[model samples]
Target: MKKHSKIIIFILVLSYLLSGTAFSADIPDDSNVEIVSDEVSAERYARCYDERNYEREFAPGQVFITLKSTTPIVEDYGVLFSEVDVDYVKVISEKFIVIHLVEKTRDSVIDAIDELKDSEYVKFAEPNYRVYSGEAVVPNDEDYNLMNTWHLQITEADEAWNYSTGSSDVTVGVIDSGVSPVADLVANIDYERGINFLDETEPPIDIYNHGTPVAGIIGAVGNNGIGISGVCWNATIVPLKIYDTTNREYYVTGIVEGLIAATAMNLDIVNISYSSLTGDGMLEAIQNYNGLVVVSAGNNNTDLNYNTFYPAALSDECDNMIVVGGSTPYDYRYDLTEQGSNYGDCEVHLFAPGAWIYTTCADGSYRFMTGTSFAAPMVTGAAALVLSYHPDYTTAQVKEAILNSVDQVNALTDLCITGGRLNVKNALLYTPISCGDLNYDWRISNVDVIALARYLENVLELTEHQLSMADMNGDSVVDNTDLDLLAMMVV
Candidate 1:
């Protein structure tokens, strides 16, 4: 009898473990549960689609359900609606599940969802929403000459190159249609590390021919003597394809997924050239990202403050976000080409050359494209250069450097917050200085004189900015002569 009792106790314990403690309590009867209308679920689904203005049809006979985090795996969840003819599709995440109802039972999808919501194991249920990309227009200019890359000179990229041509340690995530490994980008982009979310495990090819040029503008090979130089010649590009060609539009879900993936890779900078009126998911993901995000203020030719666009409007909340507007080669804020650029004192932060911008295109060739899409990459490249120089700089610091170093333009006074155009030269040369403080102790004393003497004697290496500070005579050269002056001043 004693042996039989022990055996029974062990069997009960094993059953509890295997059944996920199912024996602890009985499954609740959902028949008495309140039934909620499908409208609640549809509203949540519509928000994900951003289809408030347009009439959209929900995926027929499909629904998405999320299980509570604490809920343990159970095979019965799949067949919860088996009697109703609904079938479990697959699991999207640990807590999210997809389900499909047969065509004959299409009207029963909502009823199945209501039943699932009433279950104790389910967290919530909603319909699978469809999303599409915003419209991107690029005007063609046939007079494409090598001199079409005048925007680079206007932004002082040529001069900034002397300080830093970007570092291999810096990676810029280009989330767009897709980026092809053109000849000019072969050496600059990290093709092996890139991803195509549109089609899992496939190379991100530029079918729409938009991402390649953007990538070229950001990090095409420099001094190759074959094509125009990119802003950051050495920065690595991580192409993330999110657009779906089948729909001919970018989906909000895809954009959010791309942003999350880029954040996971811990990229130094992310460039988003597309603009939409709704993208709360994208905004949320960006706010949580640790790196800087450069976005385009749409080419809609309107003030974004009143006609707000997302990602650009997200700047109001995300400190790491930089919203770029278009500027003309003549440095005019409201020129013919820039008239279509969106602006707002609080929304749009800075301007860069966007008209007649020359960059690498698909098929291993170069072309002239015009849009705010082309301008955002310039800032992306500049931010990459700054990070290449100071990898330890935080996102906020990099943003401040870019915004504060702009060359103030009067025409941009009421249009943009900075009221100026991007100046990579100024950003590269920005250094907080303290005169007569060679040791950076924030004090001028005999210790500074000794430090200056050591630096001049080549016994100690000083940074370029530090060396400039040691040049107390302001001759732009640090030598023993300056050491003498420092000693006299200290005495």
Candidate 2:
């Protein structure tokens, strides 16, 4: 009886399909057609559809599709799209095609994709998703000038200055367009030699006006009273130009060569404000170098947990790399930074001020720019400060100090790995505690014993490194037994 009932229900469903009376929810309102698919393919299609926040439709009557095929598509393949009601098709690449739909079928992008996927010649089919710059915030910093740099005040750069303004020995490689010899930049320091991989010159030129500001943020001379101060006042700036003005784009070969040049120079910090889908030779160069590479998390305002971006996405593969996201001055009170900044709990390591940043321009002037591009140099400058203080510190130790010293903020939770923003003062003040130096004075003494006892009694707070040092017995706990051993060592 149950089998008979099931057969009857199936017949009723088949009747609805044959009659074309039952409408499919999968069919969009504008398009009356639906693509039939297996359950697994349907779920995959739905997931992909939900991932994009489509602001608007593509150009009318046109859609882009990427296809993988078992056999090379012949010149006669134009007939394939004609069968699906697509009038014209252009081959973008061996794997990419642009379909021009007839006016009536313009809105049936999904239907066309479904039809193409069902073909035996095609292995897979998907839309060519559009990508945008992640930068969004544009707050005016006119009220706060060089005398009172608001970003410096918020990050407590003054307090950090008490420890170290920056060392001339620390060199920062600005891996962007190129640096300019603007009066504010050149008057204080000579034009340091740098490589222009785009044009193959000794001193890179700033034609596009992007790299100058990034360089200014990293190491513009401070206290000259003429213009703004940078994070590191005395650090050397090396311009490794990779952006090509002719094409108005950054090629992978130029980027790879720029990284190789920077690595060869053994720069203390390499600041990359841009991102690419592929890392290629860049990741290997960074790994081979002894210094740290600070990269922007990109200003796309998307969740990187699922959508991977390069260099920033390669954080796990390279320990010397730090992926930074953008935050606003109001991030502490309210996360009012640019909405376009890309973030991931695992991919992005930290956040810094990126909106309306006032820095050097190409024409010996200053202006405000916004992007993860601007935000990356802040952390790069901070790393420079750390290196200036401890020039001998290993790449891992320097990275540790910067990561551990961030100012914890509730607003950045789950957006970055550190769950905090850059705090230059805290980072500069942080001195990695040696195994037995519980007091963190760079030496083992009776004071360490006293401090350890207070910590055990819950009267004092201990930093992570301090707590590790307090575990004198090497059992990974700060217990009374460890306290006894600490007292013995003190004696």
Candidate 3:
């Protein structure tokens, strides 16, 4: 048959097989079929078509070993193994089988399954949908703008005088398709430390142009009258490419290895613009690493009610990962913004701008791409600034401050997990608890009375070396006056 004829026949057969009430009926008891966990069972997982509103909890994904069998080649079976998004499929042995399904919509998967059900030739169909890239999107510009966008005007003097100007001395790891050392934009940092987890070669080469753009957003060289300015002009970017230039094959181990290598370099932040539908345990180990893991929530347009995807927006196992979802250039509600992003009851925190963005590309070019992949680095830039201002803060404290200081408009508040977009200004304004500013921050407690007694008695002067932190009253000197306020706190 001609190629077009074959495709038409395939479609017709699929339609005929799937159009009937096969799924509508109760699964046959004599069918000898078994229902597996939602993660392993692809049929139960529905795609999130609506991006504007998200669905609640359904089922959490899992990893398991299952029996596999070769599907006999027969026209009777409505299904035929095809490759579009599929890399390859093979049978491990007679009793064990593995097949890589084509990457398509939930509708395609369901259609394939419906066709498979009536076929006596094939035993079963299980999904391996867990493959992912560690990426996510932020909200739109309007959503982020509502949070008040603060632009830093860094003059030559500012760059020289500012201790940590625009993420200087910080290394933001770009773990994506290798970065092109576009000398003009990035200054071509060190490539020796980077590893090609996806292709296993020198990591910094930009074969696909994805990583370079991401790098530009985080730390593009600025102020040389360049094409565009990066969020962090002075920060040193560590390019850790995790994707292949040709035929992007996302591997979990590559991300794990990248995280391990980046952490070993003591990187301040690792930006992952990739995500998968399946969880990789190695990623959890990577998350436990010392550096921060910032991931893209994805552009899949499905509710992340459960941890269905891996890495970025979904890998709940990776403890320290900040899963970022997208918002548009403006906070307009639309279906495209709805799906592929995930949320948790309390965990999925922080949102940034992701839609309709233009940025620099590899080879000194510029392009506009859409996805959660781009959204993450903006926050990564904010993080660099936070570290620049407050070098004493820990990773956990930084995460809290970032989440707490977001722009909380109704559009983002309802859609985003943290209920706001990142605010660089508020984050900069946030102050750690004063050692002894009890009047401004006195939590009513019994200890306040004891501390107050000492203050009044003169036995414990608030300004004394040990009691200086207890100065609730302003006055540069901590004295009995502050203790009176502490006593009031107890009462």
Candidate 4:
């Protein structure tokens, strides 16, 4: 044989022994949770029984009284109405008793409901707002149209929906200020349950359009195709209003109860774009809970290099939750994003376009808003698309696909741990990263040649998959040709 040809043969043989496959643990069995998208526009806002529409769908800001049970009884409205002033009492549904309270207070309403502890009747009483704190607030029309100070790019909205139309049954819990059902942006929303923890009543009227706009960004119904599309156009959004604008206090217990309810409902994702430092219990509950919870990094622009803000960006002990930071449209650092965006060598996870995101609002209107609040639902919507296809993926796995497969950013590597922004297009392209380097230093000795021979002959135990890095020829398979080529090149 010619000297070069012999060298080629020798190199090819040596290459086969060096290439090896790297694999992570396979997906766990219980990870296949399906996305619920078929019921996107079902009787989302109808009365519990689907019988008739109430005069006006209850909004988050409105106050009310909820009786303990659904049984027909005209007892003295005294126990329920004594502590707080009663505006009007009406039976909106069989199971829910409505009391229009004059005062929306925790002490007053809880005291009124507490008085009934001995009565064997009224179940629970609370104020309600459609939006909760830690939930994303949708910016209004002018705000939406304003140039995003973060310089984040708004890709054609349709590009996202092309991947997966969205799962109808998957419920996205909007825990922000509150939302109004009449907004065209969220016109097709499915309100599974509304709680007015503010005044302890049934009707939840959104005083602020914050929650409504966030809801539009995550799950605005599509193909009706009238308004801008949400990340998950076909999913159900459970509006949980838990904020009080008066004192700027968001009840932590209300958040805990919201997550507790979402846990019971088996919601696929909870979008909390709002945050405060006070709610550790609620944050812990969300972290500890088994379902998927996506939270904003926070809007506070303080230095976060030392410590993270709250609930959404909590530690990995609650692995099912994803903490998202905000990115500008251009994928550069945005000062508007909470300075607390980065974590100290911890998983602050992914970033999304949150500067001045535009979406639907209450009262059949549209608007724009900024904050990490808007950024989170973008990930939630993308995760919904992935879950729709890979329903078997656990919350952790889904989070992995998203966090691992994000589009790498330019200068923000220190800001974002994954070093990328959330890109659905890139996420679906992910395969496990490989680590094998079989052909790196292998010599063309007789024994090494024999190992290669055995590997190809199937005599020695060889991994079924091989690293592409070792595939010198660029073909996917790593074999004798690669080994011989490497040996000859060196010899």
| Best model per lDDT | 1
Runs of candidate 4 with Cα error greater than 4 angstroms are 1-157, 183-188, 245-248, 336-347, 428-491
Instruction: Provide the overall lDDT of each model, using Cα atoms, as 2-decimal numbers.
Output: 0.71, 0.68, 0.52, 0.55
**Residues 224-296, model 3: lDDT tens digits:** 5545555665677777777755666667766777788887888877888877766566555565577667887
Candidate 4 to native Cα RMSD, angstroms: 26.4
Candidate 4 similarity to native, TM-score: 0.55
Tens digits of lDDT, candidate 4, 1-491: 12353244334423432342012222223223221223222222111111211111234223344555543465545344454466666666655656655665444444554454344455554444333232222323232221321211232233434444667766677777766775344454555365566765655557777777777777766555355556665777777778786776676676787788778777777777766665667756785567788888776654354555667435444557777777654555446432534332254566787755657766666555667778888888777766664565566556766776766666567765576678764454333221122321112223333334445556554443233433545566767664454333222
lDDT of 2: 0.68
Cα deviation at 349, candidate 2, in Å, is 0.5
Using all chains and alpha carbons, the TM-scores for the candidates as numbered come to: 0.58, 0.59, 0.54, 0.55
Writing each residue's lDDT as its tens digit, candidate 2 over 373-394 gives 8888999999998888777666
Over 4 Å off in model 3, which ranges?
1-164, 198-203, 312-319, 332-347, 432-491
Error of 4 at 97 (Å): 68
Off by over 4 Å in 1: 1-146, 334-339, 432-491
Q: Let me know the TM-score candidate 2 reaches against the reference structure.
A: 0.59
